[model samples]
Target: MIRIHEVTRRFGDTTALDAVSLDIAEGEFFALLGPSGCGKTTLLRVLAGFETPDSGTVTLDGRDLLALAPHRRPVNLMFQSYALFPHMTVERNIAYGLAREGLPRAEIRERVTEVLDTVGLTALARRRPQQLSGGQRQRVALARAIVKRPRLLLLDEPLSALDKQVRAEMQLELKRLQHEAGITFLVVTHDQEEAMSLADRIAVLDAGRVQQVDTPVELYRRPRGRFVAGFVGANNIFAGRLLASGGLDVPGVGVLPAAAGDAASGDITGLVAVRPENIRFADPDGDADAPLQGTVLDISFFGGSSRIAVTVPGLDRPVLLTAPGPAPVAPGARVALSWHPESAVLIEETVETTVETTHG
Candidate 1:
């Protein structure tokens, strides 16, 4: 387990981590997800003792992690570059750390062989980094890291170097390795889908501050604020004020019904976000409960699914709808977008300023 409390790191005028705190449970696959310059990697470095925080403390299994040197800490960081010695064969690369630790030759060989088997690279152990494929090289790097048997493993974009197919393969591979190794994993990545698919829980970051931390399903379905709603996935956002009748009233659109927990009693103005998949296409002249009429702008196909963009009156951006199978409507056709009230998520308007303050 790892714990970070009020950790802050800054570089001149820019702050990389702003009083961020988090907990990683034992054997949990946790992910730090955000865009570039969001401090996810900086925070990972702080945990690894490669970077020091301006304030606050880091503890692993209740030990003061910051007090120990990088190598002394019970943790291993797998860098994005793989960082393998080009001339060293896979076996040597994996044995490098144990050898440096002055372990006996027999012990090193045994551990190296065991880890090579664990990572499914026993056959490639004789090959050097240059002779192996990118995925094999990555396995070499991972085998090298895990051979030391650290209590925690830090992965910094571990799959970033692999091709798309290989990356997808390694995503599942990484999870299997973690389960087999029984070491807690804290991975840092900017790819949302990667985090969603690989991590048990994710901490979404932005502008040097923690935005939201939850399961991928929870974060996607019930985003706490506008930034989260916008960043986690594609959403159609409408600015409006909350009405007493359990709905949101917008200047351009009528009072739209709110999702279960979205409605509040007083006068509150905010943005209402609806996922594209939640919206359905209907005939403009049909007798639906409530529909927003719009002109179909375009349709895009993605194998099994399709996305339709609709231009509605009084809205600056087009509304997007995701549906299965072929295109439902062609461009320049009039359509209506409909969804259940439970599909909408209301995000308070002041969340932007609050996020700004925390990030600053």
Candidate 2:
């Protein structure tokens, strides 16, 4: 288990981390997720003992982690570049750390062989880094990190260098390795999909502060703020004032039904966020009183789903809608859209926020 309390780090005029706090469960796969320059990597480095926090404390199982040096701490950092030695073979690369610790030759040999088997690199043990594929080299790097059996392993953009297909494969591989190794894994990633798929819980960081920390499902379904809602996935946001009748009232778009969560009274400023998949095309003849109407602006097909962008009358941006398979609606067709009242989330934050640096 690890506890990071009120950690702060600064770089000249910019604050890299500002009063960030988090608790990572033992042997849990946790992820620090955010955009570029959001301080996720800075926090990771602090945990790895590469960077010191200006204030606060870091503890591992009640031990003062900051008191130990980088090599003295029971932690290992796997860099993004893999940092493999070109001249050394895979076995030698993995054994380099154990050798540096002055372990016996037989023990180093045994540990290297076992780790090679764990990473499925036993067959290519004699091959150099140049002879290995990108994914294989990644395995080598992972093998080198895990062979030490540290209490925690820090991975910085672990899958950023791999191709899409390889990245997907390694995502599953990384999870399996973590479970098999029984080591706590703390991964820093800018990719939302990677964090969602690999981490049991994620901490969303922005501008040197922690915005929200929750399970992947909770973070996606019920975002605590506007930044979490927009950064986690594709959402249709409607900025308006909260009405007494449990809805959001826009100047031109009228009242949109939303679930008023804990907001007992109305007349407050808020926003309603809806996902594309939650919106449905209503039958114009049957449901004569559809609240929202728009013209289909464009449609894109992605094999399993079709994305339809509808041009609403008063909204600044087109409302995105997703449907299964090919939709029969054309570009110029008029359509009515509707979603369940509970499907919309009422964000009470009044400030305007832009998620320009977010990566999906």
Candidate 3:
């Protein structure tokens, strides 16, 4: 229900947003994800009317949203700090906005009561913010924002303050709350896990531009560009030239398996991206001409899986492999790595700059 068209914002010589455009469907849970200073929060502020763009337009339901005042706009921004009143009780804090808007006393009471129950804070409605935990305070902030029944809700790092355990719980809570409220939710977060778990669709931003916008699965499986591939998840990217047979020719790694659809005929150079989970340990008796053979550098075990780092002959960095359950091979063991041709995604680079490689 929201369309942001070519929005550009600048602070002095630094451009915060550069011709950024996005479409958020009605009742859709969307996320603006990027690292620090990638312009995600700036874009969110532009949508909420807190920051005016130097150029471009914003529309909500086909109406010009920029023309409306912050308070007049049918949108609410929940700050990262939660911004709850320390002195006021939960119900009173939630009802503050409605009271200021001159809503009827009875209507305010009804709305606050309903929202308190919706957020499962009915029993603690009379408790002060200091009395509540971080997660509870977040719910109160959410309750306050939704009490207005906004057409859109903008959340800025909504779960950053909570511990890892509480953060996970609140992630599920946030998704459930958004679904129940039927509001268009646009959350800004640098946490990839948060965005992937809570948002139906995510827009990955980098250098003040949108790298790609897609569902969590597509963003993980088929990243359209180098930044998206490198940022969204753990990917082993090989810089190489594309062969006529639809394979990537890495200088020292030899020809790695890739899909022909990654590039048309005559394309010279591209990137081959493979996820660790997609790579497997080839049997010792398997093809000796395997594309990659490495010495297992080290292995770290998580509860459900193991991560093995393999030092290849010609690669500057070790190739990572994820095995289920336990370490399949001991450290310093010779292992052959293989993956399906279709598992490798070809990313045709459009820029000369390089993305920082991530090690799992």
lDDT per residue for candidate 2 within 1-360, as digits (tens), equals 899999999999999999999999999999999999999999989988889999999999999999999999999999999999999999999999999999999999999999999999999999999999999999999999999999999999999999999999999999999999999999999899999999999999999999999999999988877788888988887777666656666767776767554556546676668889998999866787676888999999999999999888877788888999998799999999888888888644574432111112
Error of 1 at 323 (Å): 0.7
Model 1, CA-based lDDT: 0.85
RMSD of each: 3.4, 2.6, 2.1
Candidates 1 and 3, the one with greater TM-score: 3
Number of the top-ranking candidate, with TM-score as the measure = 3
lDDT head-to-head 1 vs 2, winner = 2
lDDT by residue (1-360, candidate 3, tens digit) is 899999999999999999999999999999999999999999999988999999999999899999999999999999999989999999999999999999999999999999999999999999999999999999999999999999999999999999999999999999999989999999999999999999999999998999999999889988987788788877888777666666767765677777664344464576668899999988756678678888999999997999889888778888887999999799989999989988988765532323222442
TM-score of each: 0.94, 0.94, 0.95
Candidate 1, residue 85: Cα displacement in angstroms equals 0.7
Alpha carbon deviation, residue 223, candidate 3 (Å): 0.3
Cα lDDT tens digits, model 1, 194-222, are 99999999999999899999999999898
